[model samples]
Target: MKSEPVAGVRPEVKRRAEQGSQQLQGEVQKLELENLLRTKFPFDAIEPVPKGEFGGDVLHRVVGAGGQSGGTILWEFNRTKNWSDAWLAKLRDDQRTAKAEIAVIVSQSLPKDVETFEMVEGVWVTHPRAALPVAMIFRLSLLEVALARQSTEGQQTKTEMVYQYLTGPRFRQRVEAIVEAFSTMQEDLDKERKAIMKQWAKREEQIERVMGATVGMYGDLQGIAGKPLQEIEGLSLQALDAPVVNNRSAAE
Candidate 1:
């Protein structure tokens, strides 16, 4: 059963996010995030929760052709000056209330350890700009799970196992691996794109000069070389653990 939202935010009781100092900024960020998700990911349905809504700032439902269910994601946006551990517990309760499989908090201020994005205590924390890319990986996971469920529609045993795995710690570990891999790639791409754009006026022309001419071939070169070729250098990539310094040739 759905709970009817109570209206009004009590400034005295709930600060920071509820009719508090940064409420206005938080609200704007929430709306902007909603718009970004909708524009980038057409497959999912993004619903902005009313001001007094209990669960989260936004509800993201994964929808496919013929109304296929791919689970849901609960998003909470914050533009506060400091990070709060309280949000995690609050969102966990909200996640249960909304029956969302994933809970994500997009904020400018994150935990000391987390720089860009990371899963902390089963909740996803990310910077606002990186939110879209992080969300793309999440949506893909949901879709993959949906497809698996579809294939095992009649097999109750397999379905049960799948459900178990999803709720299990191993699932979280696997998802973390997926997120880390994607995060590394995303970081590398941004760093490389900027470096390449600066070095060559016509990037396509430069790619042809290097080994393998076509775009696909250029991509293969990147995959094989891991980092940008020596022709492109003077760029620093903070390796997350400890981002490596600018090297002449980051090539394998």
Candidate 2:
């Protein structure tokens, strides 16, 4: 049996398929770079620019300790395209608009003599392998320069005031002074409490003696009033045996 003739693939279909494959590969590369940046610099902030925003793939903002913003770096990625001068111009524009200190292009293609990163027309161009290192260098250098400027301009004096106060020896001395004052106050309070308690005891003893005398006077008055001796004895016994009010229960 004769086999049917096979049809050749159309040129347009092949071209579209190739383009789609390249697009997919580019996306994968972008994601890998993004993840690497995020993992390498956990403290820094990394954001992907939306399409038609800055013509940049990612934006990285360096963050100092205590959540202070340090500097900005703008990044662009190229997979299959050749390096072009127009890209540098676009990067410069984007850097200005983003207020970024550094602009970098990570590409798979590089000039014949270029091995890693090189400054070309004020924009940094690097291979994929060197992208992270280049980015880190720019970020740290810019951050250090910014900090130095701030220090020289006295912009950081207010920020450092609290830190100095909390960490200085004067703070420790003040704390010790407070502790000593509190101890003295507590000792005085204890002495005053004891003195009040002693005075209360003395008053209670005097009251008891007065109560006994009053009972004795009542018995004498009954005798003078000419009551019977049996009734007088009973009244005197009752007066002397009267129950005292409990001050503690009343206070409670």
Candidate 3:
């Protein structure tokens, strides 16, 4: 039987892949155009054309114009062969940009490869070797732009921690069930704990009142002038010496 395409892949997935491929092609074509333009001799001159004839005329013109010769120009152009399709394709596919960047450092060829990296907060962090050919370097810059655009999708589908734990079919129903159970048990536990704490607090107040009366009686016996006050000085020190009793202290 003939093989068929796998099912369940949404049409949008295919569309996105196609769109990415198209973009890659357009980028590659732009690189090629830049490389070709760079090769044209009059790229910086008044007229955008080869300056002189190829053979003898070029030689005589160069010799007559100045000290430099046609051979020197040819040699310079040959050196620029670094800006080739093969090199650009290498850069496009290479995942280990670090190695390539290292090679760029040793070569010290193109100024375009000297890149200024910025922080996430938009601060200039570092400027690394921008040593690759201009066309390839510019094309690689596009990858950073593509990465920024791709990151937005992650933000678009951003989920809270609770959502991650409780997602999928029947999610809301299961979550509600769990929440209802927790709520019911939690309320009873909280009520019992609060009641226990309230009882302790009542006992604590009674003890304080009794201690206040005792202090007053002692002051009266000691013949002090004013009503004696129950000044609880650093009872927290006593509590600290005692064993920890739950998050709320028994004395507290």
Question: Candidate 2 lDDT, tens digit per residue, 179-219?
Answer: 75699899999999999999999999999898778777877
What is the clash count for each candidate, in the order shown? 2, 0, 3
> Which residue pairs in model 3 clash with each other?
113-130, 113-131, 114-130
Q: Tens digits of per-residue lDDT for model 1 on 1-252?
A: 997756555553565455564777677778888998999878778887666657678899988766788888999988878999989867876776677889999999999899999998879999998999998899889888889878877767877887878886456646665776699899999999999888786777676566334445645677788865543332222322365655765653
Q: Which candidate has the top score in TM-score?
A: 2
Model 2 segments more than 4 A misplaced = 1-8, 155-252
Q: List the residue pairs that clash in candidate 1.
A: 238-243, 239-243
Worst 10 contiguous positions by lDDT, candidate 3: 55-64
Task: In model 1, state the lDDT of residue 221.
Answer: 70
Q: Worst ten-residue run, lDDT, model 1?
A: 231-240
lDDT of 1 at 128: 94
State the displacement of the C-alpha of residue 109, model 2, in Å, after optimal TM-score superposition: 1.1
Error of 3 at 19 (Å): 75
Per-residue lDDT of model 3, residues 163-187, tens digit only? 6436632354345446756898999
Can you give the TM-score per candidate against the true fold?
0.55, 0.56, 0.21
